[model samples]
Target chain A: MPAELLDGTKTANEILGKIRSQVAVRVAGGGSKPTLATVLVGADPASITYTRMKRKRCESVGMRSLKVELPAETTTEQLLAEIEKLGNDPGVHGILLQHPCPPHIDERAAFEAIPTAKDVDGVTLGSFADMWFGLGGFDSCTPGGIMRLLRAYDLPLSGKRAVVIGRSAILGKPMAGLLLAADATVTICHSRTPDVAAAVREADVVVAAVGRAEFVKGDWIKPGAVVADAGYNAGNVGDVEHAAAAERAAWITPVPGGVGPMTIATLLEQTLVAAERDA
Target chain B: MPAELLDGTKTANEILGKIRSQVAVRVAGGGSKPTLATVLVGADPASITYTRMKRKRCESVGMRSLKVELPAETTTEQLLAEIEKLGNDPGVHGILLQHPCPPHIDERAAFEAIPTAKDVDGVTLGSFADMWFGLGGFDSCTPGGIMRLLRAYDLPLSGKRAVVIGRSAILGKPMAGLLLAADATVTICHSRTPDVAAAVREADVVVAAVGRAEFVKGDWIKPGAVVADAGYNAGNVGDVEHAAAAERAAWITPVPGGVGPMTIATLLEQTLVAAERDA
Candidate 1:
């Protein structure tokens, strides 16, 4: 049987439609429009493109977008000051900082500067702690998207064995925390792990977040396992070698059509949620 | 083969003795005496005794102690302010707010007030993030103590399958994070977990922190498994039912002497470390 795809694009659209109606109600009530402040450091083309796309999405959903761009040579102190400015601004409900700032800039420090209440991107220490501690609030967009996808499928997360490959701050680690909060037995593996495939073979659910292209072979999957490929390689390849994994996975997400679209959709949904909370 | 005991009282004394000399050096060099601040709310006899014990330990090492006691009726705002004062105080290198602060108080908010830099107790959001992310300056004392006990015995951690039975903010969850950081495949189990004994049986290392006396059975432990019990039930019992487990485990910590003293020792050790880092 072919693996059933978790269509992120369709799911995202469904969420966006709901958000549109909610935004209309708030506007009709004469409430201030939900405002998201986007902060981009330096002129990285990819960051610029992503920021523009997010802003476009916000506009389409009847939300306000505020974009702030900074020079490549900006110091941490300066960037922090800018973030503080947005944090205090009455008009802004959420702040999203395009990450991977210049190596010299302390990105974590920069992320920390965003007020916890306004951290729509959920990159602050407070947000990370809430996610890790299972206390609730916003989550990293992509991982949040994966949770949404799982919930949509009506899958049982409680008491399942979930093996997460990779431990990056933004995705893998947070994803593992989310799964654990859902009562899943979570195992985190990385490059230093002696045998990743063996770990994967025992998983009821496998979440692949390691950045390598097609790193997880199809033969590694347990039969009837739910496979989530959160990895996106340069040519649209995922951590899971799709062909082989498709044969074994009862449910699988494709790299391009799967996790990618869901990331931005979750971001928008959470931004609206934060706006409501703030309002 | 009979299980070897992991002695905490002896190990804690050894660590404290080392810290004492270092503190002496700092005093001789005309540096300010290292300080540990304890914010105790109300007169819980148990909390009082624990704080006093911690203060006595600090004094033995030539460190200064600052005590802040509040009434049981203290507001969340009042407690938060006290913690914030300690966090910002340069004289307070370490801060420990006695846990189980009056039930009405927002314990997490109080914990949040202590800055990561002075969170020698490792209960704050900042410290938790650092601990989980593995870029650690401080860790929760109990878990750190457990790690120390394991390392002292030359127990192998990397790539081992570890099961942590408990998911409290201070103990089990952080314990799993520490093990994961050490490259162990960590599984965190809570009361909601199903087949906990089965999960425990598969572990190379099992840490019982559920606070229930004798909850972990002998049959749950794998042959030659390493076990760390951080439970301190009333009347000197521990989370792991000791007698039968001793027969199965390769190494196991006894209840009273196993993890209690190590936790107190780790607090002092980390306090001194925080002081030196500040110096």
Candidate 2:
């Protein structure tokens, strides 16, 4: 039998429904609605679209969105100043700096400016440490969403062998940390990794976050393994070869409606959490 | 032929010599000497010995030591207040909080209170993230010592498979991060790991940080691999069966004069760096 689709869109909708109801209860209790501040540093079309989708998601859940748009030529110092302003703003319960700020800008420096209290995007170093140590801090959206998806499917992670392909700070690295915290034996494979196929073959859970089109081949997956493809490549392609992988894997995520929708949903959910904590 | 020993005593003495000269230069240049403040919450005998060794090491290198001793009944808030004082004190360049601070006190909270600027012990969440991301920051002492050992021996790590048998924040987790940053494929195993021996068998580099005597068997080590035993179990036994491992491994660290001395050396080096930054 082919793999059961993880159905991220359905899971995302369910989450959003819960978030909407929670927002209603808070508002009915005379609590101020949660607010998410998003800063976009460049005019990259994909980034623009992502920021718009995130803003739209915030509005759909009855949360306020504060969008700060900057030109492509913005300096790193200017970007840091803007983020610092949002971090200090009393109205901003959560802060999100859209990734892939223009070249020549120190992205890490910008992310560090967002204080842990309001770092809903979970991009700061403090949040990363907390996530890795299982200390209940906010996690990066896509990895956090993947965990939620795994929990929703009732997939047992403890004592499982997990292979995380890619080591990007936002996705791959934290994904491994989360899996490790879940008691999974995690092996992080990157471009320099000598035997990616061998590693994936031994994995009970394979997380592909390499941002390449169908980079993880079907044959590499173990039969009945859970495959989470977090990459959103240029042509709507996921990191895993979906149809082929489905033939062998027991469960797999689809590209467009899978991890992508969940990322935005997690962002909104974490923003609600930050707001609640602030309240 | 048996594996060559990685001499931590010689390396530490060399480092101390360099630090002494550096301190002399800084003092002659009219810069203030570095100061490390150690906070011991309880009167645990082992903790007292460790703190004393750290302080003596600081003084031997021409650094000032500020010792803060508290009773076993000290509350978490009281400890946090003490750490806050040290963090804010301009004279303090580094802060070290001896671990195992009574069962009732929240140790993580106390460690978090030490500001990142003075966290030469590298116990803070910020330092962990910085170490993992390869952003030049203070590293946890034991792991930093292990890294220095690896570098001193000119052991090439790129494309190597390293299995770290423990997940303690200070030793195993940060050790894996340091190795990963050096381009090694890293796997972290802990008590919950189903097959520790199997993981060790596949590793080109095995770092045993689990606090158990001879926990990592000699047969598990791959022949000609590099073995770093970080455990300091009672009776001077290491996590790896050192003699047996040395017979098979190409390079190995002996228990007494190995990783232990390097820890103090790194703490002193990081304190010097912190002081220089402050100056």
Candidate 3:
């Protein structure tokens, strides 16, 4: 029998519904609608689309969106100034900087400029530390979404051998920290990892975030493992060989309808949280 | 033959000598001596001793030390105020807040109050994120010391399997981050880990920081594995069973002179680096 599909779309919808009602209550109580300011540098087609989707989600949930689009050649100082503006805006409860902001921009500097209180997208170093130490702070969206999905599926994390494949700040690294916080024995693997398959074979939970399509073979998965594929490669391919993995794993997430949707949903949810705190 | 002892005192002395000469050069070049401000909220004997040792090391390296001793009943706000004073001082390049700052004190809050640039002990959230992301920041003292030991021993970290026992922010967690940054497939095990021995058995390197005497038995170590006991339990016992582990391991750290001296050495070394950057 195939693995039980952990439907991220359904889970995300449920989370959105809760956030929507929370926003409604706040508005009904004479509070202004929650606002998220998204800053996009350059005209990257994918980034533009992502920002649009996030804005649309905000509007759909009765939240406000503040869009700031900059030219491709925006300097790091200019970007930081824009982020600082949004951070200090009384109307803006949360800030999201659509990533891959041109190769020339000092991305980390820009991230650092976002105030920790307004960092709903959780890109700031403060947020990263909070996540790593299990302190109360917003998490990077994808990792936060992954954790929520695991909870929704009732997967036991404590004492489980979890292998996170990738070391990207937003995904693999934070995922490992989250798992470790949840009491799982966490191992982080990357391209430099000598034997990714060997590591995966020993994991009770395998999180594939390496951005390579079908990089983790189905046969490499431990039987009855919980597989979370956080990759979105070209042609809708995921990091895991899903069909093959489904044959061996007890639970798995589909490529398109899984981690992707949850990422956006988590962003929206955290925006509401920031709104509740700041608004 | 027993396992080769990874000598921490010798390595620490070597590092101190280099730092001493660097300090001398800076002083001769008309630069003011670097200063490390040590903040102690309580007069816990161990904390007092640790601070004294750090101050002595600072003096030995031609750096200055400013000690701030507070009452045991110091409030979190009071502690924060004291740290802020040190942080704003022009002569203070680094700040070290002795840990176990009274049960009533909010240690994390106080640690966070230190400026990132002056966080020579690497206790600030910013430093933690920087270290975890391999973005070139001061590491927590013990973990930084452990990494230096590994490098000094010429242990190949790339693609090696490293198991870190314990999850304290200052020790185990950062140790895992440093190892992962070095390209080791790093696993973090804690009290909640169901089969720590099993994890240790598969490791190419085992770092025991659980603060328990002889918690990691000799049989748990993989033959020829590098053992780093970061623990200093009562009676000067380390987390790993030294005698037993030595029988099977290729390298092991002694309890007293292993990680202890290196911790203070790294702390002093980082203070000089901070002074170089900020002074």
Give the top-scoring candidate (DockQ).
Answer: 3
lDDT of 3 at A40: 94
Off by over 4 Å in 1: A43-45, B84-91
lDDT of candidate 3 over B126-221, digit per residue (tens): 888888888888999999999999899998999999999999989888898899899999999998999999899999999999998999999998
Q: Which residue pairs of candidate 3 clash?
A: none
Question: What is the DockQ score of candidate 3, to 2 decimals?
Answer: 0.88
For model 2, what TM-score does chain A reach?
A: 0.99
Q: How displaced is residue A63 in candidate 1, in Å?
A: 2.2
Query: Who is ahead in TM-score, 1 or 2?
Result: 2
lDDT of each: 0.88, 0.92, 0.92
With a 3 Å backbone cut-off (N, CA, C), the pairs that clash in candidate 2 are: none
Q: Mind giving the per-residue lDDT tens digits that candidate 1 earns over B197-258?
A: 97898889999999998999988889899999999999899999898999999999998988
Q: Tell me the tens digit of each residue's lDDT in model 2 across B65-166.
A: 999999999999999999999999999999999998899998889989999989998888889998989988899999999989989999999988888899
User: Pick by TM-score: which candidate is best?
Assistant: 3
TM-score: the better of candidates 2 and 3: 3
Predicted complex 2: DockQ? 0.76
Compared with the true structure, what per-residue lDDT tens digits does model 2 show for residues A1-279? 999999999999999999999999999999988999999987899889989999999999999999999998999999999999988888899999998988889999999999898888888888899988999889999999999999999999998888899999999888888999999888888888898898899889999999889999999989999999998887889999999999999999999898888888899999999999999
Model 3 gets an lDDT of 0.92
Chain A only TM-scores, each candidate in turn:
0.98, 0.99, 0.99
Residue B257 accuracy (lDDT) in model 2: 93
Higher-scoring candidate on TM-score, 1 or 3:
3
